[model samples]
Target: MTACDQARELQRIIDQQLISTMFQPIVDCQKGTVLGYEVLSRGPSDSPLHGAPALFQAGEQCKQVISLEQACLLEAGQSCIRHGVSHLVFVNVSPGLLLPKAFAEDRLQSLLATNGLKPENVVIELSERYPADNPEALKARLTALKKRGFRIAIDDLGTGYSGLKLWSEIQPDFVKIDRHFIRDVDRDLVKKEFVRSVINLCERLGCRLIAEGVETVAELTLLRSMGIHLIQGFLLGRPNPFPTAELSALDNPDPIGGGQATSDAGYLGRYIVPLAPTASLGEAWQVLQSSPSIFALPVVDNDRPLGLLHKWRVMEVFSSTYGRALNETKPVSSLTAYDALVVEHDESLEAVSQSLLEDDLHYLKQHFIVTRNGHYIGLGSTRSLLRMMTRSRVEQARHANPLTQLPGNVLIQQEAVHRLQQNNPFTCIYFDIDHFKPFNDLLGYSKGDEVILSLARQLCTVFNGDSEWVGHIGGDDFVVFSDRLEIRKRCEEVQQLFALEAATRYPEAIRQAGFITGEDRDGLPRQFPLVALSAGIVVADSRAFGSAADLAATAAVAKSKAKKAVSGIQIVSNIAALNEMSDDHKTTLLA
Candidate 1:
């Protein structure tokens, strides 16, 4: 169809109000409740201009966009009322329609009033499809809407060219991240960082962030962990013509960051306070004076942190002749140290400390900002970080095994107990040197110590990235535990690596014979095989074990069976299965 025909079609849809409104829920992930719905308008399904993009394009060409948008707003409000949706309704509005004079007297407000919808119940989602004709005019209109109790949201943030600048100017009450950023946030570190940074920025700016287009459980979980409570996506609930304002339940939801325990090496959430970016230097001075203990304050706009304001720096600025008069009235954000150290609340305290130390020494005096997602949670002093590190080192020393430096019995038990509560599938492999005591006596304790250290390093290297735990249960006994499916392959690799290392470490005569003559107890000389590995693996069943101790006992039984076998590898399904295996099969090992 020609542009003219498409224009006529758009006009008819607008005049007759034939647009279809689909209500997609915006959920509060943490609370597990539906916060509101985003009103998405569709043109007549039978028409060529059915999708939002096509219809808007047609309207754009025909100079009827304002009319089309107004019509959608009217219909969306009525549709919400008809559907009994009492929550906040978000409607997309083009940037072109944001002129101050036009919005001050626009029929959009009147249409909402007719449907019994107040400005507070409506959220004007400023679309980024078209650039603003006049930014100042748009800001003026948005400011007026805000004053009238209407909530403003900047839509498709991060994907748009002018989103940051627009955010800085208008400081919307909410910001919707574009689908591109949220598409695979769970798997993409870059996207995670981007979203995290956006979240922080939103917190500093005092703006609510809504993740758009969340399509997977991983994505939803990651967003929730990052402190993003408001989410909209197909994974939660798809947009429908008739939608209910009810949150769908998520299964087995993990805490933020997968319940990964925080090391004592990170900053806490005690020092964070909300300071406006537009606050005057005088206001900043008053804040610093009131809170004499804090070294810095995080400067923010709309709960999204911009940077930090150091008390010393501010005082230094004001100490200069005429400095107070020259800059007192200026926004505190203008003087904020944008490069001040900013770290997530979950970041390793050591990592944050190292970054500060490695950076220009000047930043040491500037207190670091601690944020959850991107919003300012508090300020962490360099002194506090150093203190935490000292305590962490002491704790590490207490938990680490002396021989191999791996975690000892206490920490190992703690790790096992934590996994038991999670109830995820996992395998635990318990292994020990086959003839460690005899070898230790024959080769002297020094050589035996080397072998134990070598095995520890091998275990750590093999299971390093699987989120698995390697622990020394003391003596020659060590365990490799993981929920990864490849644990079987890793166990084999460990056995093979130890075999090769053992062969290489022996003298020429011992290497050739694969055995050594050593004096056994009672002064009797005997032939003993070279050092070998014995591993017993248990694939846990949630139904079988009530405690970590029960699981450990079952794994010990499996280990004993593996030790008796000449080849030294035994895998059992569970504690019950370990008892059921025949004597011959239980002793059999992987080739």
Candidate 2:
């Protein structure tokens, strides 16, 4: 369409309120739940301005950007209400539209009220895409919005002009890292460092940081390891008119901290009745006085958790001569400890422990509230958390491999059994170093240990995802468990990486010669090829195998076949056919 036609179409879109809103979930990776949904506006599919860029560009050209944004905001609110979305709704707004003259505060409030939404439940996300001419004025306007109970977020952080300056001045409650920084973050060291700095800054500023546009599990895994809990991306979910509050992609059986079954904090929580936010201080004091064991009482409104009320704080007020009479009738919410750490029940114990260590010492002596999907569940004590941490550390040390510090055979067996019980299709890879004994004999045991550790590191780097696990079966033998279907390609990458890494450990001449002179088991001289990797891959497609031992036996057969292959990789897809092979045939195959 021509420029004039585009402007007319844009005007018609704004006038008729033809804009449609699609909601994309922003997930809390640690909790494996959706924290909120960001509202995305798009023009009608049949129009030339169907995409956001074309629609907004036309608005800017026609000088109807403010009107277009207003329509989008109203449509988003209506959609949210219609969909009965109770979680936070993040609506994008241009920086220019945040000005008092461009968008009136009363009108904004009226829009929220009309949709049956509260200011606290709606986040006004201002994109740094449009830099403000007068930041001080914008800051003043944002302050006014904050005072009115609206949360502010800066979108596309680090990509627009004056990102850090705007972040410092506004001090938004949330900041979303642009997609540029999130894409291939696992491979790019500079992007990783930049994100790490952003994470630290957000923590120090007491602001929530979200990593946007996570398209791959590698990026998701790396971001989660860096302490980024909130994430948004096409990998998790796509934008839709109606989106589910929970994402199955985030439901990782083995999360970043560890396995979810043992690492979740919900197991540590004890049931403690919560105090209503409307309860008076006098009533709260009575509750605390009656229950001397309760150190902190959760303040809950409906099913939602507001904050916590410490017994000590409440007692101090009541102890004073005039304090009781002056504040006894006030609501308990007035004394709510907003800063108390509130964690989701599914949050890993390791993550919760990190949060505690980062906070003041006072938290060490008190209790933290636990919630499930933002609803009050129970209270968890620091004493219990510390005790659990100690036990976990002891168990891990007992089961971990000494050389590489990876999981040992006992844990490896348990992991295999767990995957089998889950009955999900997965790949079990057994990795063996070819001619490792000869290499150790020629290059000493200490140098041999270096190769093992290097191989362990490579396995970790290549299989670093939520569903991937690497374990050491002792010596130069390691095993990998992964849910990815593309195990063959990943195995190829591992072989290529190990080949390069193994070459570095050999002498210059030995490397070029492609062989090392070493004594054979018969005490005779032989030519051993420089260390190479041999991988045995078994794709488990069903519950045909009863136990880990049975699977291990099949994997052993596969390994024997791999050792005799030229490519050093063998895959066994049919367990029944492999089992039917005679012992003599297997021996011949290995030979």
Candidate 3:
């Protein structure tokens, strides 16, 4: 058959949109909620008349393939709007197909706006298994898209020629974790570290990191432990033709943040409350009155969380030298739960409750702290565990997004200040979601959240609580304290891991891999330009500063250096760096 003759026949099917668009729901693996869907082009049945390959194979190569991609994007965009797609809608394309001048930005915008979508709501993915397309063309289009509120991603990285070239070429907002690194992530340190580096880079450069092909609970647990706040995998939800669940509605539609939200679909399980050891005798009494089973209230001041009045500890206090004044005595750590354990709020209630049950009988601590990141939310006691577990379910049903479960800012500041007062070594990691706002704007908050949660999970693993405490300071910013010695190394680890994860999770770079871009901030042509990351590492040590404010300022300075230095970790090891940057100008300018 003649090419044109065959093209006419293929065009009939392409025009019909017969190719059933397959969907893979992106989920917050840590929270077990659907966050978004990736649109995949599939064929109806097995016939050549219905297959994407068949249509393209029949003289539909360049023009037809490009047309088909546009069609799929338009369709997916419509689906997101009609279904209130809370999560991102990922649409895949190939560089070979997309780099053509035909893939115009203005035309695409018009099509999307027609479907109630903007450049911000879609994450354009590359379907190929290699790096980059025409360097100049991809950059030209992607930059234009970004300016218009669109975000770019590199899909299925680590499976092909995904390398530094691709990454430097197209600084994508989201990096899809190829199944290779995701499989057995819980068991593989290499994989864990690899993904962590990507997240680190994401945090530094304002990019979003996402893991693809996640299929196991262990993987989910590992990611959650690493501090990843979002995820996607079969363990959470499967994709459907339509958006089937509510995963958002929790994001601040307005500029402000934080509010009480709950859900009925899942239980919050029981969140633990930390009692101040020296809670004025009156406060302790009040807490006990509100909760009779509160055998102890955490005694917390500016230092670490301390214990409350243990049944036996209380008796011991009365029998001591000052037995008569025991009731009014200064709160002591004696009543505290030694080695108090913590579970993230996004975790499964069943597993956490079971753990509590197993340890309750022989428990040294009477409460469990329910936390998101590392900030405390509330206290979960043995008595309230049951009731609160049910209540948690209501919270989950009421609110769709599980990525954010912590109470909010007031608690975040308390946690930060508390760590500072402890005088222990801590690592302050000022995490910025490389291009998170743009990515979120492009893919939707749900998918953006998936990236956030994923990074949180990665950091938790790398920054696991030591004397080194890790906590979310809000938004994309996070901190970690490792008792002095390891604090510096830990910060470096976060930096490296972030870059690697960003490479893997974003497909735009992978598809744009071997290409090069020459552009300035103004979009004018330039020389060998590309996008990457900048991270600042500040170690919480005596030489650096004594207060949280000082530590934060030093850290912020170091972070600026990292961002400006291109690659490599910058540690504020001395007062000189801090000294050189004082407000009063005690130092002379180097002429």
Top-scoring candidate (lDDT)? 2
Q: Tens-digit lDDT track for model 1 on 1-591?
A: 987788778888988889999999898877778888998989999999899889887887888877888888788888888888888888898877667365653466786655578889889998664688788778888888788888999999876567888899988999999999998554444566688789889989999999999875556766776799998988778888987543544653332222233232222334446678888999888888897777788887776778888788889889999999998999888788888777776566667877888878654544776666786656667776676567656765687899887877766765665567567778888988886766777677888888888999999998886358899998889987788745667787899999898677678888898788887777798888888899999887466676676677778778988989866878877668546556665455210
**Highest TM-score: which candidate?**
2
Which candidate order results from sorting by TM-score in descending order? 2, 1, 3
What are the models' TM-scores?
A: 0.48, 0.49, 0.39
Instruction: Give the count of colliding residue pairs in each prediction.
Output: 22, 0, 96
User: Candidate 1, 152: how far from true, in Å?
Assistant: 52
For model 2, name the residue pairs that clash: none
Ordered from best to worst lDDT, the candidate numbers read 2, 1, 3
- Lowest lDDT sum, 10 consecutive residues, model 2, at 252-261
Residues 130-190 of candidate 3: C-alpha lDDT, one tens digit per residue? 4565667766777787788877787776677654456557788777778889886643435
Candidate 1, residue 485: the lDDT equals 48
